[model samples]
Target: MPVTYIPPEQRKGILESPILQMAMQQRMQQQERQFRERELKLKEQEMPVKNLIQMGNLAKSLSDLGLDPRVILGTKA
Candidate 1:
C-alpha cells in the first residue's frame, strides 16, 4: 500500500482541530469512567465475600464455645 503523504501544514491543522481534540478528550473520559466503574464493581463483590468469611469464623468460634450459632446468626431454630 502506497503511503499518502500529507503536507506538514495540513497534518498540523488536522492534529490541532478542535473537533478532533474534543473527541479525543471524550474518549479518554469514557475510558477512565469505565475503569473506575469496573474497580467499584470488584470492590463491591469483595466486600460480600469478606463479610461471609468473617461470619463463618465467628460462627465457628461460637460453636466451639457450645453456643448455638443459628441463634446468634438470627436463623430460626
Candidate 2:
C-alpha cells in the first residue's frame, strides 16, 4: 500500500471552496439558532413559575386587606 500526499495548495483550495465554506457557515448558523431556541424554551418554562409566585404574593396582599382573592380576581370562592 502506498500513501498519497495531497499538495498544500490543493488542500488549501479544497478547504477554501465556496460550497464547503457555505456549508460550514450554514452549520454554524444552525447551531447558534438551535442554542437560542433552547434558551427561549427554558425562559418560557420559567415564566409560569414566576407568574404563580407573583399571583400568590398578590393574593396574600389582598388577604391582608380583608379582600378575598377569588372576588378580586373574578373567580369563584
Q: Which candidate has the highest lDDT of all?
A: 1
Tens-digit lDDT string for candidate 2 (1-77): 99789998789888999999999999999999999999999999999999999999999999999999989977765
Q: List the residue pairs that clash in candidate 2.
A: none
Clashing pairs in 1: none
Estimate every model's Cα lDDT from 0 to 1: 0.95, 0.94
Cα TM-score per model: 0.73, 0.72
Candidate 2: misplaced stretches above 4 Å?
1-9
lDDT of 2: 0.94
Task: Give the clash total for candidate 1.
Answer: 0
- State candidate 2's TM-score: 0.72
lDDT score of residue 13 within candidate 1? 89
